[model samples]
Target: MALAYDDTNIFARILRGEIPCDKVAENDHALAFRDINPQAPVHVLVIPKGAYVSLDDFAANASDAEILSFTRLCAQVCTSEGVHLAGGHDGFRAIANAGPHGVQEVPHYHLHILGGRVMGPMLARKA
Candidate 1:
């Protein structure tokens, strides 16, 4: 299936400078910023500069440079936010929601880095 990217999405606007974001870290291929409606003490969103709709799309379509830069930026944010396991702080959770089942709010490919406290179960068990 062809991935549809909506340039008018909030992340796109932020990338285009049409909107402002509380930037945490940035590189040539990715931008990490604090989530406006944070779910945790350290809730940040990292988005690629490219136009991709979801994590699968990004993994399949993004260039090596884009992938590397984006991954590195995520690590950078974790360490800087004092949530990286290597930093001797509590670990972090990296989440990428996709499609309707995932309840993705934005149509752009973005990774959410959440930490600074226990995250509880990965997901509530469904009967």
Candidate 2:
């Protein structure tokens, strides 16, 4: 089931130009910008221009062209940001938080590209 699209989300505002963002890269289908609160030295966010609540929503509702474009734009952003350096010797991590359990703060779907340092484990081990 597709979730309702929230046009009032911060990302939507950014995409609509209602708000300003430190833009990194933009293509026909996606827009990338530096995160206001970054977790890593190189923290960028890539989002599809279309409105989707989460990754599942995006996968279910977005067109094939939108999917391909968004994915390609993400890789382009990584390359432009030099995240994958020296022929992939250095790499970055792309993350998408889902619902409440996944810690998704924003309603709109986005991919967080984090790198520029050794990204440690994703979670701490439970003792």
Candidate 3:
């Protein structure tokens, strides 16, 4: 089932211009901006202009154009941030945290781009 879209979410507010954001890049279908509470040296949040609660919701409910545009915008963000180097070892990580288990703070689906330095593993080892 498709999740209800929450317009009150911060991302929704940002997209609607109800809230201000430090925009980094924008395309016809998506917006890229710096994270207020960054977890990495280079942290950016990319989200589709469309309303979707989670990645699953986005994948199932969003249009093909929106899907393509969102993914393309993500690649653009990595490139623009200078973390994704071509023909080199330099690379970046794009993450989409979903639901409570994934620690998704916002109800809206978004991608986090992190790089510019060596990153640790996605999870810590169990002691």
Candidate 4:
């Protein structure tokens, strides 16, 4: 039997075309779509095609080649999206949250590529 993974979640639905999304990029191994609740001027989420759950899950489930391809796609997206800037802290920030402690809203393993301006920390900072 095949390995188990929940494919009924929202992002998984988007991956399966059960839900429509503002698609930014896609490859055989991954798909990139815009964030519905964008935190930055350019906020896109990249997910592995067969992702069943969180990064922890994906990490455990995905093959080594899959992981490598994911990293390559991350670089590719950064390039294609014009997120790579010359100066430090001037480009996009790729984020993959593992679980609740990591602020992962969606269960699927997804990376938030946020850029287009100076970005702050993920958490609210005290004054």
Candidate 5:
């Protein structure tokens, strides 16, 4: 595989406005959009603005501000998606795909926030 992911690639295109997406939320550091093929009722992908191969790449290059933004965005998406929080009414899950073997289709760093209804156990615990 390439040393690093190319932004001009698919997910990056979506992030750059080269292609349209069901954008949920965005800031100077990150972007959130609905998953085209959602596994759960609410499946939003929160990705960084810059190009990074995967979660590892993001961790390596992300600044303190970027890291904070990513965490805040994740919480925001959970709220927007109605995921149970301190006083939230619904439930949600935050998922990040790491590498090829981990089922990462997109090369960009993103977190999939899924919710809207009760879901079964996580992949490891799924029947």
Candidate 6:
């Protein structure tokens, strides 16, 4: 399905310099920043500099350089946040929500890197 990306989304605004973000790291194709409403002690968001509405959109459409930049930034954030296993930290969770079922709040593709504490089960058991 072709998802229509909303350029007016908050992340788009941030990228356009209309909104300020607590930036962690950035490259030509991607940007990593601290989430304003953090859910973990180490909460960083990695986003590609393209108009993608979801992870699948990014995966299928992004160029090799864009993909590499986004992936590298994610790893960079993990290590710098002290959550990378190689960095002697337990680990971190990378989450990308999509569509209505995924409860995606923004229309831009973004990865949430959460860590600094033991994250319990990936999700609550469906009752």
Q: lDDT scores for all predictions?
A: 0.94, 0.90, 0.89, 0.78, 0.82, 0.93
Superposed by TM-score, candidate 6 places the C-alpha of residue 21 at a distance from the truth, in angstroms, of 0.5
22-105 per-residue lDDT for model 5 (tens digits): 989888788899999998889999998877777778888889889888878888888777785768476677788877677888
* Error in Å for residue 27 of model 6: 0.4
RMSD of each: 1.1, 1.7, 1.7, 3.9, 2.3, 1.0
What are the TM-scores, per candidate, against the unseen true structure?
0.96, 0.93, 0.92, 0.81, 0.87, 0.96
Off by over 4 Å in 4: 1-5, 86-89, 122-127
- Pairwise lDDT winner, candidates 1 and 2: 1
Off by over 4 Å in 3: 1-3, 87-89
Q: Can you write out model 4's per-residue Cα lDDT over 55-95, one digit (the tens) per residue?
A: 76777879887887777887777777778764443688877
Residue range 9-102, candidate 1, lDDT tens digits: 9999999999999999999999999999999999999999999899999999899999999999999999999999994787989999998889
lDDT of 6 at 85: 94
Cα lDDT of candidate 2 equals: 0.90
Clashing pairs in 4: none
Which 10 consecutive positions of candidate 6 have the poorest summed lDDT?
1-10
The digit string of per-residue lDDT tens for model 3 on 28-87 reads 999999999998889999999988888998898899999999999988888888888775
Query: Where does candidate 2 stray beyond 4 Å?
Result: 1-3, 85-88
Between prediction 2 and prediction 6, which has the larger TM-score? Answer: 6
- Superposed Cα RMSD, model 6: 1.0
Per-residue lDDT of 68 in model 5: 87
Q: Candidate 3's C-alpha lDDT?
A: 0.89
Model 5 lDDT on a 0 to 1 scale: 0.82
* C-alpha lDDT of residue 55 in model 3: 93
Q: Of 1 and 5, which scores higher on lDDT?
A: 1
Cα lDDT, model 6, residue 96: 99
